[model samples]
Target chain A: MEQISPFKRLIASSLGKKYLMALTGFVLVGFVIAHMLGNIQIFLGPEAINTYASKLQNLPIAIKWGFRLFLLTAVAIHVWTAVLLTIENKQARPNNYADEKTVQASYASRTMPITGLIVLCFIIFHILHYTAQVIFDYKDLHYDLNGEHMHDVYSMMVLGFSHWWVSIFYIIAMGLLCMHLSHGISSMFQSMGWSNEKWRGVLKITAILIGAVLFIGFSSIPVAIMMGMIKPIIGH
Target chain B: MRLKLKVWRQKDQLDSGRLVDYQMDNISEDSSFLEMLDLLNESLVEKGDEPIAFDHDCREGICGMCSLTINGIPHGPEKLTTACQLHMRSFKNGETITIEPFRSKPFKITKDLIVDRSAFDKIIEAGGFISVRTGSAPDGNAIPISKSDSDYAMDAAACIGCAACVAACKNSSAMLFTSAKISQLNSLPQGKPEKDRRLLSMVSEMDRSGFGNCTNYGECHAVCPKGISVDFIANLNRDYAKASVKNLLKTIG
Candidate 1:
């Protein structure tokens, strides 16, 4: 309309951030599923997981690096956009009522970034324990499984889960991921303009399915290792 | 019938407002809600006291200027009707109605039951229009909007901008009000060119104006005199996303 008030620009641009949040979030969900699937190779055997890891590493070195770089960009853009939008929402109001409660958005929608941040921390720890070790020759830590010097992939995962705090963190972080995905998936559809009245119900069901699959798939890895269903390969 | 009412009284936006009690009697059931308030004003005038000032226009549901919040429900205990059209017959004789201004940080209180609604105008000003010039009245049949699409768009357009959505919402969310405008023009071809720009600007203005995020309580639609549905909000989210992609593509290409 009138070009006088520059305040309009700030508001108009926020809709952009909303799109950034939804699209980046949807792409990240795909990453989460793939990451969990990669981790599940531990259940197969050390040779299976190491072979999988080596193959992932062997793929056009630049492309592998490029993919990681792309993932980082997606994560950074998503967080920065979310922060700016949150600031705009908060600054518009000076004094809000104490009991301000939202009536419509699910718990996941409200707590996305908080959960997202947690998942981010989990990713860092995961890289340190597994990827970092593979990359840099860190101190080889292991548990005495039948007095064997077995620091294979299976042993590393099982030993890591044996510690109480690490297992607890994974469970909590996955819970957040599930909560984030529960709302994030549905919201992604809304953002993409896929909200036909007839299909809203279908989209909702699909989101629930995706969330449930990731939750169960992620939680199973640590639980199985902690339960000792998968053992360390000795003297590999 | 006689009744005591706890009406909010304030001199201006800077004045501290409070619930001031007053009594009125011999009011008729058939009298409109405005008439009941008129009788209260008459009594106050006779007593040499300043009559409680409020906002009202058209005295019909169509204008949406009546800003009374009776019994915690916007526009009183009525459905799809503004306060002016609400009749006293809906309430008992001895009932003391509690009236408050819509509590939005953007809607500053000008006086009792009267707040400045310029925030809505600001929201509209922040890109609620297309680039078309007002040359003359366009023919209705020139731009053929689908019957179903037209109905849905009109349903959103029916929003009177009363700020009841803000008043009725626990979080003071403007989702219904904001989304209605977004969806109304978004469904039609005339609104296609600036669809993304319009939605992006309005939502930013909404957030900038200090309105809370929609928590989906559905109270806004329930208390709305227009009975606008929450589905419009979902439509807003949908269109906003498309606008973003469209904009991004334009940037890259």
Candidate 2:
């Protein structure tokens, strides 16, 4: 019998595909935490966050673009593998069960794909709204404060959240991202082959807590802004 | 009681099956689901027509030979009950029950409601057993396994190899079935020597069999006649990962 390559075997197997998703998902998850922390700098007032944003912009091109490229590749592989697995799963059952019923899977687990797709859409919309500055004006990038012109990221964030619609969109997307994380976090361990009966409960609880923290941490910025807790920097 | 059955009929594995409507009258409420089918077959035989063909060996339900999808459920509507144990009384007098064979690429239809599940046997043959000496009977208590481990093993051992999990799964994945077998042997002391080998080979065969990947959908446990939990799946996955890592290290070292 002809032997198949181990490398081919790993990615071709169901477990292999799951491992890819779990690994990539963890990377994205770490990115989200870092992003939340960075975004929260706005709460420290204008000079603190603007300085921070400028520092990021001042980083060497290799470091900055390399990280962005890595993230983009991870996202691409994650989404592509997911689509392939879903197609294969669908083909497995040519005919749907007549009297379908859900017994044990949570709503979050079942809706992973839907929630994931929504998160993807939100990511693109977010880039357009803030990074590309194509959706709506948050603040003038060339605005001069203290006789020095730089991107007014703090004013941009405040202006973006000041609009009820944008804040609502961010809040809703973050909520779905929480749901996605809750299911993905626990499942990631399972795919990595570390889960067992004893750890199942602990893992599930931890996943929920992580989801809750992320939702609160990310959503707080918009909520605080909408409620007039954080105002645009005057005279900037 | 009278009941309407939308029974699936197919000539062979390659043929597309259709749900043929049949009316069954005077079915006793006490009759088991398979027994009701027997009654319907008797009527069809009397009329010189082809009887609905299905697989059932032990009407008592332990054999797992009986397989049917009654009203979109793998083992009828009852939870934790096989078709052979499901009584006609569970359904209303005039209810319509849709009966179909377990549909999955791995499980192909041989006839009316019977599907070829030998793919499961192939998977078992891959590495579902521990090597033992062919000698006089050994003392059962000699191994001295922990009570908790023994019980956990038994929970997995209870699986009867029915494909109900596959039928119920939206993806028709056999993660539950495959995992049960893995966990059953993985928990026992005697099977420890071959644990890594067993997991890798069995999973490889499973992937080759064209079964779908599990998305952690709990439908498999919900429709399981033996009520196997999805926890074993997590254990199996964990073991598989460890085995792969061990195997890779062996190559590098």
Candidate 3:
């Protein structure tokens, strides 16, 4: 018999794929929470948020590129592994029960693949709209704060979400992202063997709480902008 | 009680099966689900028609031979109960009950309501055992096992290999079944010798068996006739991770 390498075996096995998914998902979850926190800074006024944005922009090039590279890899691996697992799962049940029924699985748990795919699309569009600034030409929205000129991310976000359709799309995508995380959070714990009977209930509630917080936090920006509660800095 | 049953009837592995409706009259509500099937089979035989082919043994539910998806639920609506143990009283009069064989990629329908579940046996064959020397029975207290460990091991040992978990899972994953077997052995002192090897071999075999990966939807435990918990799967994940890392380190060393 041929001796397969342990690294190869880990990637080849179903359980191994789950470990990869869980690890990458953990990274992505951390990024999402941090990203939400950063986005909510806009509520603290333009100076606070613009200062935060400038700080991030002025970070050492190596650290910035390193973080971006890490995040990109995490997203890629998470998506690639999910696609493979979903294909395998679909093939496993070629013939489904005619009278299908769900017993204990949550609505969020059952619709993970759909929610995940939609969130992936949301991430792509989000990057294009905000980071790339190509969606709506926010390139000229520069602000001078403390005699330092910087990209006016605050006004960019405000103007970007001022469009009713854009806000609606953003809100809808956040809803799906929340749904995905509700299941994905606790599921990552189970996949990593960190959860069990005693902690299952607590973990589930925690997952829902995190998802709820992210939804409210991320959606609040768009909602506030649409309501004119958080206006862009005048004469930017 | 009168009832309507839409039973799946597949002549053979290659045949495209269909649901054949049977109107049964005067069925005893107290009768077991299998007994109701027997009554239906007898009527079909009397009519000079082919009877339904289903698997059942140890009607009390211990043998794990009975396999049927009663109305999309393996072992019917009752919790911690097998089809052989499910009484007809659970259903309403004139209710249209749909019955189908346990479906999965690895479990092909051999006939009507009969699927080949030998894939499970293959997983067991991989490492579901301990290599013990043939000798006289040793004293039970030779190995001092903690009360908690033994109790946990006993809980895992309750699995009857029914594959109801596999049938109930949308992914058709056998993680629950494979984990139960692993936990049952891995928890005991006697099974400690080949712990790493057992976890490695059995998990690899389970992956190769064409079963889907567990997504933690947890439908498996919900329909398990033995009330097996998904905690065993968590344990398996932990054990497999440790074993894989240890093996990899050893190879590098």
Candidate 4:
């Protein structure tokens, strides 16, 4: 491989880290917003949510695979970039706050990696349950809506919540995600330079709103299912 | 009231330093932080001791020359105000304030609480100007900048390059400072012609200056005397991206 030039070095630098963070962050934000919009369909009663799920499955095979591939790449790059940047930051400050100083950064900044790792595990587990059928094979995970079998994505979602232990863990994971994205999104805009006094107030409010909405929206589905508000598909 | 100060002391850039605790009694509550330090220096001078050295000018915070990290915070606790504006009333009658210089590779300390921020000057020289003829000044309304843009331009222009951002950053990144300067120019119509070149040059200079990369930490904004937002950093990136594409097209054309 040719030597990486100084120009390349600058682009790969700590400042360069912002480029990757901003790009992937924007991508994931797009995915989350879209995911939530779709998720809220569940609130429209079974017909809409299940039909939407079925429609998702009925997408052309090539398009379906394309979406999957794109999402996978985004997830990999997002997590990978974060892990590498966090390590670089850690190595830069080998020891810190000498003389027993109690001064500290916010919990989110300090534990970005840990929260990211937890969210990673949750993502893997989440995919296996919904995207992959084997893990939640025990949950009778299929339902037909609008004359199509969407791998019973809706039922799987509902059933995943019906299990008290699984839902509890999911609640914990989403809570961590809320903490991560809350700071992550606002920080992303700041790094990119869209931040100003007037907009700073708006961005902050938007960050908090996104975090609270996602936390409640994601957490409630499972909690509501576990509380018997939605029934598990027994079979057929 | 009397207070204890454990301040970082070093004779020069090459010297290793440590915090040395000094006690002073009956320090007036109304005394400015620097004034309190002056009292310590006065006592030391009278006792035939080496006076502690630091930096200050304008003593009003506008010049961004008074750089000090007090109690692990850049310019002490007040928001949107510099060390000069920070008065002694903010502190308790009996308190310990630890002071240090801004730590970053680009900012070499000449003495206690004073680091050379000439790297910022270098970056500014690299791109922070709009070329114009010296013969005559342009009419004020000729540019016609949108109100929103002008307002934000003022916000970005508010940055004083105090190095507080680097001090507060976990990575000691100067992105906030560089971006604010870039945005201040890049936002206005007058500054638009050089937008691409300015961003590319300044960002490149910032990296060349041995500053760490910004990790999107908001500490810099938190401690900034003028409250410059990180969004200017975003506009910087956008401009740079646009500039890169523009540069490429210009090269081809």
lDDT of 4 by residue, B67-158 (tens): 88888788888888899888998998788888888777778888876788899999999999999777777788986889999998898888
Candidate 4 lDDT over residue span A1-236, tens digit each:
34444445435655556766777888887888788789877767677787887678789999999998987898887788787776665544343433322233567765677998999898898888777766768345555655655455566677667778888889899899888888787777776657766786687678878988998988878877777776755653
Across B86-175, the per-residue lDDT of candidate 1 in tens digits comes to: 998899879878877777778888988898999899898888777788988999799888899999889999999999898777556787
Candidate 2, residue A221: CA error in Å?
4.1
Between 2 and 3, whose DockQ is larger? 3
Best by TM-score: 3
Question: Could you report the Cα RMSD, in angstroms, for every candidate shown?
Answer: 5.8, 2.9, 0.9, 4.4
True contacts kept of each: 0.19, 0.67, 0.83, 0.28
Name model 2 segments beyond 4 Å from true.
A41-44, A58-63, A134-150, A161-169, A198-202, A220-230
Q: How do the residues B185-210 of candidate 2 rate in per-residue lDDT, one tens digit apiece? A: 98999889999989988998988898
Which candidate wins on DockQ? 3
Return whichever of 1 and 3 wins on DockQ.
3
**Candidates' TM-scores?**
0.73, 0.89, 0.99, 0.82
**Candidate 4 CAPRI classification by DockQ:** acceptable
- What would the per-residue lDDT of candidate 2 be over residues A1-236, giving only the tens digit for each residue? 57765566667778888888988998999899899889888889888888888889889999999999999988998898889888898888777765566666788988888898999999999999998878896555544558866788888888888889889889999999999989889888877767766887798899989999989988999999988998877775
The DockQ value obtained for model 4 is 0.24
Most accurate candidate by lDDT: 3
Q: Per-residue lDDT of B122-210 in model 3, one digit per residue for the tens? A: 99999999999879998989989999999999999999998999999989999999999999999999999999999999998888889
